[model samples]
Target: MSHIRLLVPLLITAGILIGGNGLQGTFISLRASQEGFSTSLIGLVGAGYNVGFAIGCIYVSRMLRAIGHIRTFSAMAAIAAASSLAMLLVIEPTFWFFMRLLAGLCFACLFATVESWLNASVTNANRARTLSLYRLVDLGSVTAAQYLIPGVGIGGFQLFAIISMALTLSLVPISLADRSSPAAPEAIRFNVRKLWNISPLATVGCIVVGLTNASFRSLGPIYGQEIGLSVTEIASFMSAGIIGGVVLQYPLGLYSDKLDRRVIILVATLGATLAALYLAIFAGGDEWRNLAGIFVFGAFAMPLYSLCSAHANDHAGDGEHALVSAGMLFFWSIGAIIGPLFASVMLDLFGPGALFTYTAVVMVAFMGYTGLRMSARPGVPTAARHGRFRSLLRTSAFFNKLAGDGKNGDQR
Candidate 1:
């Protein structure tokens, strides 16, 4: 009970920070459109964030080790808040891009700091409950934050101020709390070759999700605006996707545990590809059709990461779970950095519809790749499979530990 009490401040801080960041992401896309930024330029701006995120994932642990979680969170939160405000002040494309880059770095570190603390504080007995609560906070905060764009009217300094305030306020609970800080997280080192050897399918799956999901989130608002949806509708569109993601996690997880995970991944990829194709070709400007299409897309697409993680861990030997998680994330980051830039170019050349057209193409490619891999390799037998399915948030490597990665040989 006392340990859980210590986690309250961290969860509160995560909710505030994640909500602020989520709103800012969607708003940035909408605002960039209002400013008449080209699709290509906006894509570059979006990619900038991932680049900084990738860098932070690798280096922030060093800072954490030296200064510890509280100080690291404090410094990063201050910088993130400043960067949020800076974006409001400077309307130039170049300036906004740099600010987003800085924001990404700060957010990666911030999430890492909080997740490490949570990881350290929980016992294996209660880890699943704690992780579930944390995930609930993460999903609820992000989903609710989408509505704020329409609520605040996304136009002036006011919305930006709100975002900055939320980020800055995130610092207060942790700083004021009387709890001790956790041990600093170890620095992440990538051995891409080893990860590939463990499970090529999971490695590729992470990259594929990074490409398709990141593109959709970064540019989906623009897609809504281009298709004539109002701000309220756009909010619903985004939230529907997130909610749909939650809907399928447990069901798919149960099946993945019984059957081969590859089969699940293949089916999910096919579903996502079909949904994207439907959105690209038939959904058109209709609101309900777009909403339904995106909902199905999210349902099938979102769980692929978790399935992949489970599949990889099945093959990973003892002591390899953390390495697998970190490596997969690093690969995903690489895909994220490249995904937006390519998708943006497609959106520019083709149309708003090209957004999903881009995703559909990518999904189709992955589906084919999954087929080839399935042909080559046999899955771990059901009894031999190590872990159960857990829904994941791509916040940080330490977050994976909260799922209790190797103990009892359960899947993280």
Candidate 2:
């Protein structure tokens, strides 16, 4: 019953978040197509959201510390709602960029607060189940939100207004939820150069994961549209990949924990390479095949970073998790910035197939490096040997980051 109560607020929050983000998979591409925006420009707009999101992550912790989580979350949602609604009035790409920036900032704070709250509420005993449930709600909400796109014409700004309203309403539950005082805000002190020195492989892994994931997020819709998938089908294709990631992450993480983390990463990269190759070579103009390939790619590629993060944590003490997380996010942002540019260039040079080719090559390189590392350190276990996958799930800072203390927050 208590879990049921907890889930009520979580579901509401997920609704708001999914409403805001899920449509992007189709909305951005559709909007660009309607406006006749250049492919490169569209890519820039998509990348801009990531840049804004990264910035928000970097700064939102301090904002919450100063004002408390409830106020911070409410303000963020309000801002995001306003910005989203504002999109209806302003159709200019440059104007939309600023709006996306606002949305990104607000979304970051909202997610961070909610995730922290979820983390604080969870105990070690039930963390994995709780986190898994949280992720399920998140994935389900987003997938469902995708279905909303077909009802509202992509050109109508009314859809965005509705999304904004959802975000506004999401603030109510968190604002009124009964909870204890929030934790003291942790300071983020990132030393990227120092991180690189400490774990070069982990650092590189962060970059690769960021690049691959961001490209998938920003450009996948465009690719879908290019291949002649309808908006609804495109949504399903993108959602399927995310669903696969949510399902596969823990199992893969558990397996990585038992062996050298690098080997798991290598295997994942290889799998991603194969999936990408299949998509590039054989899935041409076939929607179902492309979707399947994407799902497989996501299963292998999306979780590799979490595994790398766990591996990095294994080498650090408890105090260093925040630092590592921050560093990883930062590197991920850098990669996110580069990923779109490279993907765009490839799209221009070789068409939609270039997306898969570019990603596959990167994975191949990472796999090669991991193999070399294994050769040098043949038998060392990079992570603990335990089937504590369920237990470890509860320990995730990612969930905490999402449900920090906000009404509608979930982070990855």
Candidate 1 Cα errors over 4 Å, as ranges: 405-412
lDDT measured at residue 95 in model 2 versus the true structure, 0 to 100: 81
User: How many collisions between residues are there in candidate 2?
Assistant: 15
TM-score for each model:
0.97, 0.89
Could you give candidate 1's per-residue lDDT for residues 1-412 as a string of tens digits? 6767778988999999888888888999899888889988888889888888888888878999999988899999999989989988789899988999999899999998998888777887677778888988888999999998888897788888998899889989988888888777666677888999999999999999999998988899988888889999999999888888888888998999999899999889899999999999999889999999999999999998888988998999877887887877777888888998999999999999999999999998998998999899988998887677777788888877787643532454
lDDT value for candidate 1?
A: 0.87
**Which one wins on lDDT?**
1
Per-residue lDDT of model 2, residues 1-412, tens digit only = 4754664675567556755666754576567767877667676776777677788778877887788877887788888888877867877878877787777667767777776666556654555566566666667777777777766767767677678778888877765666654774666777777777656777888789877877887788777778888877877888888776766777777777677777778888888899989987898878899889999988888887777766665554435656766676667777877887678778767888888888999888888877776676543353332112221211123442432222222111
The residue-level lDDT of candidate 2 at 273 comes to: 91
lDDT for 263 (candidate 2): 71
The whole-model lDDT of each prediction reads 0.87, 0.70
Clashes of 1: 1
